[model samples]
Target: MTAVKIIKVLGTSEESWEDAAQAAVEEASQTVDDIHGVEVEDWTANVEGGAITSYKATVEIAFPVHESSGDA
Candidate 1:
């Protein structure tokens, strides 16, 4: 049997939405492990004065659940 878990993360990039997604995954690697995959949940772009400014994306980060043996 395998355990699984889901988490939500927001990634922002000045270049493109793809970069933002990659950034989120890269940053998440510092705390998360056993990454399964990322799914794009919601996405939106920032615009001002009728001009595109930036991209914002919301993604779901899925991974296997792990139990820690650390004591509190």
Candidate 2:
């Protein structure tokens, strides 16, 4: 049996939604470990002058929790 945890994150990019999503995961990886997967919960974009200026993505990242073993 394994334990898993989920955390929500927001990422923004001027490129595309995919880049936003990927950015979230990449940023999370910097501090998090054992990352399993990611689920995009929502997406939004910033519009300026009738043009999209940035993309935002809300994602849920899943990872495994480390269990402690008695060693002392």
Candidate 3:
């Protein structure tokens, strides 16, 4: 049987929200494999000196769960 797992991740960037979202995916890819898709759940930002300092993205990452083969 094949299964998919979804997890929420937060990414931050000093640029645009798009970049923040991409950052999330990239970071997740470092640990997770076979990433099929991502959904941006929310968007947020931080303000410093009355200006937008950074962007934050809340994303849901989806990947297939690999079953371990009976090799041991």
Candidate 4:
């Protein structure tokens, strides 16, 4: 059986939830490969002047951890 691993990340943006979510995936992609998917487990925002000033996204990024080839 293959081992599975999971990690949680919080990515925020002043724009929208999509951006916040994308931010997380993009960052994770830099180091983690073969990202299966990202789930918006939770979300919150900062309100200012009766409007959303910032958006925060709680994402569950799931991916497989593979052994490094070490063929540098």
Candidate 5:
């Protein structure tokens, strides 16, 4: 059996929506393992001087939960 978990995270980038989503997954991987997939829930932007200064992405990261040795 496989156990999974989902976490919501926010990431921003000056590049594009893809970069923002990638950044979120990269940052999460620093502390998380077995990353399965990412679902982009929402997108927004920071506007400055009639231009988009930054792109923001809200993602749901999914990963497998490892079982402890003591599990019965």
Candidate 6:
């Protein structure tokens, strides 16, 4: 049997929304393993002086759940 866990996280980048999403996955991978996929929930940006300053991305990260085996 196999199971997966989904987690929501926000990533920000000064470049683009795609970069932001990639950043989220990269950061999550540091702590979590077996990263299967990612879903982009939303995208937003901050504007200053009529220019896009930063891009933000809301993403759901998916990874497999590992079960521990015990010896009896």
Q: For candidate 2, give the lDDT.
A: 0.97
Q: Please list all clashing residue pairs in model 6, or write none if there are none.
A: none
CA lDDT scores, all candidates in order: 0.84, 0.97, 0.97, 0.86, 0.95, 0.95
**Residues 1-72, model 4: lDDT tens digits:** 556567888889999988998888888889887889878988889998999998988899988878779999
Per-residue alpha-carbon lDDT of model 6 for 1-72, expressed as tens digits?
789999998999999999999999988989999999999999999999999999999999999999877756
Clashes of each: 0, 0, 0, 0, 0, 0
Quote each prediction's TM-score.
Answer: 0.84, 0.92, 0.93, 0.82, 0.92, 0.91
How much does candidate 4 score in TM-score? 0.82
Tens-digit per-residue lDDT, 1-72, candidate 2: 999999999999999999999999999999999899999999999999999999999999999998878777
Cα error of candidate 3 at position 51, Å: 1.0
Against the true structure, what is every candidate's RMSD? 1.8, 1.4, 1.0, 2.3, 1.9, 1.8
Looking at candidate 3, the ten consecutive residues that score lowest on lDDT are: 63-72
Give me the overall lDDT of model 1: 0.84
lDDT of the structure predicted as candidate 3? 0.97
Model 1 over residues 21-63: C-alpha lDDT tens digits? 8878888888998899999888778888997688777889899
User: Candidate 5: which pairs clash?
Assistant: none
Please state the error at residue 13 of candidate 1 in Å: 0.7
User: Which stretches of model 6 miss by more than 4 angstroms?
Assistant: none
* Steric clash pairs (candidate 4): none
Q: Which residue pairs overlap in candidate 1's backbone?
A: none
